[model samples]
Target: MQIEVLVDVKTTLGEGPLWDAQQERLYWIDSFDGRVFRATADGREIRCWDVPQKIGSMAIRKDGRGAVVSLARGFHFLDFQTGDVALIADPEPDKPNNRLNDGKVDRRGRFFAGSMDTMEEGPNGALYRLDPDLTVTRIDDGIIVSNGPCWSPDGRTFYFNDTWSGEIWAYDYDQDRGAVSNRRSFAKVDRSRGGAADGSTVDAEGFLWNALVYDGRLVRYAPDGRVDRIIEMPVKKVTSVMFGGPDLDILYVTSMAKPPLPRFPGDGVLRGSLFAIHGLGIKGVPEPRFGG
Candidate 1:
């Protein structure tokens, strides 16, 4: 399907985009710029918050609060209503180069997030699944840049991406036990595109829609690992995609402009911007917030 830009906010390293069904709003994060953005379906009523460290990812709560992964510390509970913040836990206290990245709640409403290396261009990342009891488990390791942790519609299959290897891996997920096993390569993309699979979300039909960061497009893959469809975007770096809006027919995309060169006029112009597109009317499960 063809992609049409909805709104462009010009974000720097824009990554995670989550749809909060209760509030009918979209929450996203600008990784490098340390900012979080919340907007409505019409692209109106936009609000942005400045975070102290790099804001890696965000998820809404059952009570309309926000939880963020601070790059330097651990998970934090954010008060969208009162602007108060509190730390939850730090799984990797010794690894300062690694920070939390993409994450979302599972079918059981448990938060599953991963960490990435801040210093290197290659692998040094790990995948983590946080239980409701606040126990964090290292599910997958040896990842150079961990990406999506999206689950299939049935909650039996899970998909994750290792960006540096250009492969998206699938797993047999046990929702009741909160476990993932049988790790296998789900899809491998061409390296010439300059970006691997970044953040992604699954639709009701079980198709995994992945945003190809720096490749200027979104790809839909079948459950068996076949490319089903491709949705091209205007921006070169398509950081993330999520199904949002009242009917979930709208696909909210977050993009990042190319970084500026030294002594150039493009310093902050293209780095951070929000974009949206319509036409695909797929309803995604509302992000399972903490204590859901």
Candidate 2:
């Protein structure tokens, strides 16, 4: 397999890579910068939308109007044409120290996102589900830094992780009802191995691929929680991953540039760039759009 830098944008806290198969475009977010980016599969024709607040993640709407996004304050609807942002709901209005983080849509078209404590001090955050009717529901709680939200190929299992905890959890998902239960530890990263689970995506074969930030490793996990493969990345702080390309064979990764965090230090020239992995011989399921 070969890996190439797709975009050298060097984003700060780069995360949430989303591929729109219908439009043949890729979307991503630079969390702290409050920026949303769109580019072609070849990393061409790049466009950016600057929001007023920090954006955690975004999913396209099924009606093809715009996107439903998680801003620092709460969930919002973003209009691509007029660049307008309207508040949908603030699930945690009492927690001023938390912000929404990584999220993904289920096959049934509900958006599931989790919040994180901005100070990284305690588990003052929770996971939420935004339904098609624009209503928000809390799914799980006691999270420190939320990341890596995805689902299995059959839609029966949900995968997510709390970054600082180094544990990735799996849940029994009721796809039709958008409810999750039977949470269990699917995998745990040994931080001593130089990485922590940051973001993840499931392949067509039901394997989980996770980006290990601060360690520069992409790990693929089997359905039984076995480590299937590990690919060393060129840059540390690999924040997130997604599958794109006409055939969904390319693995697109996002990384971070800033190096001030005490736990995750040291920076390199390519620290904040986007990368694409070619010839993986695997395909990804199309990301579901938000039903709302």
**Model 2 lDDT on a 0 to 1 scale:** 0.91
**Candidate 2 lDDT over residue span 108-223, tens digit each:** 89999999999777999899999999889999999998889999999999999998887899999998898999999999786886678998999999999999988899999999
Q: Global CA lDDT of candidate 1, please?
A: 0.76
Q: Per-prediction TM-score, please?
A: 0.91, 0.98
For model 1, the superposed segments whose C-alpha errors exceed 4 Å read 1-4, 68-70, 258-271
* Model 1 poorest 10 in a row by lDDT: 259-268
In model 2, the runs with Cα more than 4 Å from the true position are none
lDDT tens digits by residue: candidate 1, 94-204: 887788888888878788888887653656678887766777788888776778888998889988887767788999999898888999899987557576788899887
Clashes per prediction? 12, 0
Residue 136 in candidate 1, Cα distance off native in Å:
1.8
lDDT of each: 0.76, 0.91
